[model samples]
Target chain A: MNLVLLPEQTDSTIWQINDARQVSHLKQHLDVKIGDQIKVGVLNQARYLAEVVEIQSNQMIVTPVEQQAIPNKLPVTLILALPRPKVLRRLIMDSVTLGVEKIVLLHSYRVDKSYWQTPFLEQLDHYIQLGLEQAGDVIAPSILLEKRFKPFVEDRLSVWNHSQTTFVAHPYTTDVMPINFNQQCQLMIGPEGGFIPYEIDLLKENGCHIHHVGNRILRTETAVSNILGRLFCA
Target chain B: MNLVLLPEQTDSTIWQINDARQVSHLKQHLDVKIGDQIKVGVLNQARYLAEVVEIQSNQMIVTPVEQQAIPNKLPVTLILALPRPKVLRRLIMDSVTLGVEKIVLLHSYRVDKSYWQTPFLEQLDHYIQLGLEQAGDVIAPSILLEKRFKPFVEDRLSVWNHSQTTFVAHPYTTDVMPINFNQQCQLMIGPEGGFIPYEIDLLKENGCHIHHVGNRILRTETAVSNILGRLFCA
Candidate 1:
């Protein structure tokens, strides 16, 4: 953990950190002691160099200093077809660190029924927190699950107007990946076997541009990072 | 395995498949039968759709057909600090699937000495084959291991002259990533903890341009894929 995140505080003068994992990271990685300044950020708030006031195995108390600068978030939403359980945690963490403003996990025809049953789906907040700590940022991206694909696309997608560019990445398309893309966009990535023909049609009809990265096929995780790299300055 | 790769053949019409993993993937995933056409590629050669002549639990016989198109390789070499053993296989596989022309696994100050001793290094060809199969390509990129960091940076890096952009990804740099980089180049990525000051100086003296992706600190794997995605069309 690069930065320790504290819960919403009632008293701004001092803060108590009770999360065991954060405490351990402070104790083990940072080698904390009284008077040592640790990098810290309040939940959805500014970052600070917090001075350690008290230290223990289970908890830590610190006084936060002046607010420090934080990195900017990418102006995008990742509309991902819910991946398998084995691929969930790391993908979420990577997406969070890459600084997506939001993520919507949607269902598709190629996604197996058993994949939605994984217990890991409930730990989205934890993965977001891990990603935030890794990125040394305080604001967590909102994650929304759209179990029904067609209805969500028809109804909720209108929330993003023409000003926003929505894209669906496909392997069969002759269209090329967008270069040096910096504008607001929503990128939809398919599941393992890929989105069915009908699903691609639905997205295309909804004004989503269909593009392929290159001739070679990349795995879901690799494709996400690669696309994000070009989509923003990441 | 998306495509079946065959060993270099002595006879053009008939070929033997002896690899057990390939056999299992063909039986379970593709479910091949006699007279069935399967996508196949010869090592470092052209791709083709071959007809299955015979099938068995341990072996398969196929007849090669007309050449098919393959994806293009990235116009650069990946000069990476040898990562931990756990990260080596997948990174190599990802690099191959991303279509790099060459890879140089170099040693650096922060790289643990024990990492170089991994037996997994011997299975580089296995990872390359898996990558080629996933991308449906036949050519394998050459991998060179440099145990002496100073000598390699001072002596070998000049193989890429001023005409070819050579970069060092350093987090401390204010320089931004190069965009729409289509020409030949070499990118150097550091180890987990990052390269030391002395090593950075040595690299600077060798004409490596220092640059950073963004503010967020990403894992070595994520950083590599992110950089490649921007460096080329991958």
Candidate 2:
């Protein structure tokens, strides 16, 4: 973890960290000690230099010392086809680390029905928090689950987020992705086997520009990171 | 697996897959049946549409039906700092799937010494093969291990691969990476805490450009995919 992100803590209050996972992580991985200055950020707020003030078998305390500049999150909403159960946690954490402000896990024809049943779906917040910690950012991207693709694409996703342009990643497309794109947008990436022709057609009909990075087909997680990096240069 | 990669076979020869792993995968995951068409590729050769000629309890036979186009590999050599043991496998697989033609797992100050002791290092071929299957390509990229950072940087890496420009990833750098860079290059991505200042200076002295995607810090795998996508737009 790059940063220790705590719930919104005001100055002058003792910030206690009692969660078993975090406490163990701090003790073992970070090896925190008293008077050690650690980097921290408030949720959706500013960063600060915090000193480890207290440590016990069950908890630790940190006091914010000085404010630090927070890196801005990239203004992209990742619309991903829910991936395999095993890759779900890492993908979510990576997306958060990449600074995506929002994510939409939608159903596709190529996506396996069993994938939606994975218990990992319920632990999205855990992955998101880990991602935030890795990125040293405090804000958590809101996740939206869309089980009905047609209705959501036609009635909601197409019309929502007017300020952000929608971009869909398709490796076979002739339209190469734009470079130095300085605008907010939503990007749709397909599942493992990729979106069937009909699904791609629907996405196109819903006003999303079909874009290709190059000739190579990338895995869903790879495509997400690649497109985000290419579009936002982040 | 998008393609089943096999050893070089002549038109008249019967290609047999008797390996337990491949046979099990074909029988279970692929559900390949007799007379079913499957995508297959030759090692470092052409791709083909093949027909399942035989499906025994323990082995499978496929015959090449027609020749197909093979996607071009990206002309980039990735220089990555040794990552954690668990991540090593996925990183190698992902790098190959992303089309990196060469990889150099180099030592860095931040890299844990024990990471080099992982048994996964010996199983690199397995991950590479898996990546090839995923990408539907057969050519395996050569992986070079650089255990000594200083001498390798000064003696070999700086002089080797003159055809490829060296681009090092440094998030703290003031120089934003160039957009629309159309060149074959080698990208050096740092490990978890990133390359130390001394290492960055040494890299600069050895004619490496310190580049940043953005202000945010990204994990090694994310950086690898992001850099490959941005540099080659792939």
Clashes of each: 0, 0
How far is B200's C-alpha from truth in model 1 (Å)? 1.8
List model 2 lDDT by residue over B1-234, tens digit each. Answer: 888877777665578877688788888877888999888877777788989999889988888899887777887888999999898988999999988899999999999999999999999988898888888788889999999899988997778545557889898878988766767788899998899999999988887889888767788888888877677763
DockQ of 1: 0.66
Question: How far is B29's C-alpha from truth in model 1 (Å)?
Answer: 2.7
lDDT: which candidate is best? 1
TM-score of each: 0.94, 0.94
Residue B103, model 1, lDDT: 95
> lDDT tens digits, residues A93-142, model 1?
98988888999999999787888899999999889988888888889999
Q: What DockQ, between 0 and 1, does each candidate earn?
A: 0.66, 0.66
Can you tell me the DockQ of model 2?
0.66
| Chain A TM-score for predicted structure 2 | 0.93
Docking quality class, candidate 1: medium
